[model samples]
Target: MTGESLVYVAWAAQQMNARRDEFIAGLVLVTRSEIRSLDHDSRMVDLLNASITENVVAAIHFLEHGGVEADVEAPTAALVYARALAQRDVALSALIRAYRIGHGRFVDEAMALLAAQAPPEKALPAARELVHRAASWIDTICDRVGITYEQERDRWVSSRSGLRQHWVNELLSGSAVDIVKAEDALDYRLDRNHVAAIMWAEDTVATRDVGDLFDGARSALGEALAASGPSLMVPTDEREARLWWPADRIDCAGVQAALAEREVSVRIAVGDVGYGVDGFRRSLREAERVKVVALSGGPASGRVTCYEIVAPIALMAADVGDLRLFVQRTLGALASDDERSESLRDTLREFLARNGSFSATAKAMFLHRNTIQYRVAQAMDACGVSFDDPDAIASVQIALTACRWMGSSVLRQTNPTP
Candidate 1:
């Protein structure tokens, strides 16, 4: 390419770099057939077109980040661009070649030919020349970059998957329901709680080990997970993202070192040791939250920071025996206010003691089944448990345990506050 052509291509690349959607739309129109079919005004069509545009977007981003150096191997990007601007026949073959050497020029020529539709007889020879040119261009680029096409392809795939999983995993297993819903509406399938984190260069991670991502510290991470733990990495999208392994003894020293950088300045949270996925979820949430709210104030990443926010609830769950006693005694003293709560507790115990059959419990209390249910609901409601959730089961059970230990206090008709 002459200096004039080079300057034009460079300027064109800049335009591509800055206005990705428009550049990619132009790319899609490089060939005659695609040019004829795209609906300029349809979001659905734009979305359909995004599959190709996405690759261009990434390439443009990398180019912008790397500067205008031709030496920067825009590997794995041509195929995306080529496939998106499917102007010629053998699109798939063309895609495959874009990863290899010598194919880059062929792509440029093919795209040029695609832009100019000649009669079939002439088009055939021109297309072949274009392919040859592209293949040669790709070869030169590969040699310049010193990376095999296969290696680039692998890295590209891995990087895209890693980024996607990062987003999905963040939405899943998080308290961000609205975010999750919005993403799901966009057809991003994300099962809850299936993700992990990896340790990359501290604070300087422009992109992940596998991807060219934006600047936000990735919520989905992947790293060399310790083999002895629950699992530090899980398949966020089959490329492997780091997940919280509850049973694993956290490498605090290693983690601290990994996060020791002064820039990103975030903290990691590890969860209780035995609870498997639950613990992982809790710890991951805690760590992520701290990184968001507390990290701004300054705390290092990759270490345990209990987040103290959930301490009371956690402590109560850890040893509800004592908590239950306290709750029961407090309620027993306040019996004057709601005698039905105490009565319900006593009745439920006797009913349960006789066996879990609702009829038996109702019979022992000489109450209707519906009445018994109401009191049970009332008693559960009266307890600190949020009966609407799964967590309440244990809370209510603990309260019962405490009330049962009350000896005569339970049945004394002690004139619990009215």
Candidate 2:
């Protein structure tokens, strides 16, 4: 290349270095759809960003140095990224397409820069050289990265835990695989009745100590379920674990007692007991659903919540907007956060629970009979419904339960009357 051509190539490289972020943003925008389909893991996303930035910088360096020898090794960042992506199981086609799209965009930018800095005759040849250089470098790096990806993928497939996790994930996703084969791979019986549970750290501060917390939870759970039968616990991440044991073997009371005795900060959600292969999958799904509700119910809901008990509230509150509306309509002014309203609501809950027996409610709440009657009457008046109507009573009961479980933060009036 002549001195003038070298100047144009150098200038193009300078332009890329100066606006590196803009170039990367543009490339990402164009390839966003492909990238989204790769994997949702946070680590994979970080690798994608780092890989793009590093590749662009390396390309600029190659161009500035007059297209180095073909024997140069692939960029260290690209090789590392390829291995990471393979371990994450991203499709090879998606990885290759990202490179193709990125290089095409880089070539367009280089051409534009050359046109802006040189006359037409000089610019056309310089643009051709830049395209050749960029395309050749991309092809060489893709070959190296692709080879690394395949090797890493094969290694992952042959690992013991990898095979176990793969079968577990397949089972959970309802794939039609031989149960016997899956059992053999997992080393856990799927033919027996199962009760699934999920244990997780509740907060970021607690998450930092999750490894110890998970170990403590595992030990506690193992001891609790020992009498029931064999059990299995798998770590889904640093802060979360999934566990299962034979439904017939689990001592619910024992598990609860053991969990209470644990010193670590953790939450456990247990599914209804289910039997056999279908039951195994179903129980895990139910446990996950119940876990979401447990977290939403706040800390006062306790460390362990059974699926059977929470299913009603969890299903009812799934559509948050509708749940809020139902609460507002059923409780009316009682849903407000005033002391009087809360007191009346509590009195009504106890009165209903005691089957509308004023004496029973008084005895249970340690209040005078006259005070119970007054509060019940006040609650009925505030609620704008007669407790004599069964439908009204049922509605009020549901509203109170929803309010208690969901907490005042969600049930509080959105628009307050002065």
lDDT of each: 0.40, 0.77
- Candidate 1 TM-score, true structure as reference: 0.25
Q: What is the number of residue pairs that collide in model 2?
A: 1
Give the number of the best model, judged by TM-score: 2
Q: Show model 2 residue runs off by greater than 4 Å.
A: 1-162, 204-208, 225-227, 249-254, 337-340, 413-418
The residue-by-residue lDDT of candidate 2 on 94-208, one tens digit each, is 8898999898888887888888888888998888778877878899888988998899878866776457657877888777888888888888998778889988776654546
Error of 2 at 408 (Å): 3.4
Worst lDDT run of 10 residues, candidate 2, spans 38-47
TM-score of every candidate: 0.25, 0.61
Over 84-202, each residue of candidate 1 has an lDDT whose tens digit, in order, gives 32311122443333233112422453345343544554544544543443344445543533333344444533564434444545444555546555344424322333222332222
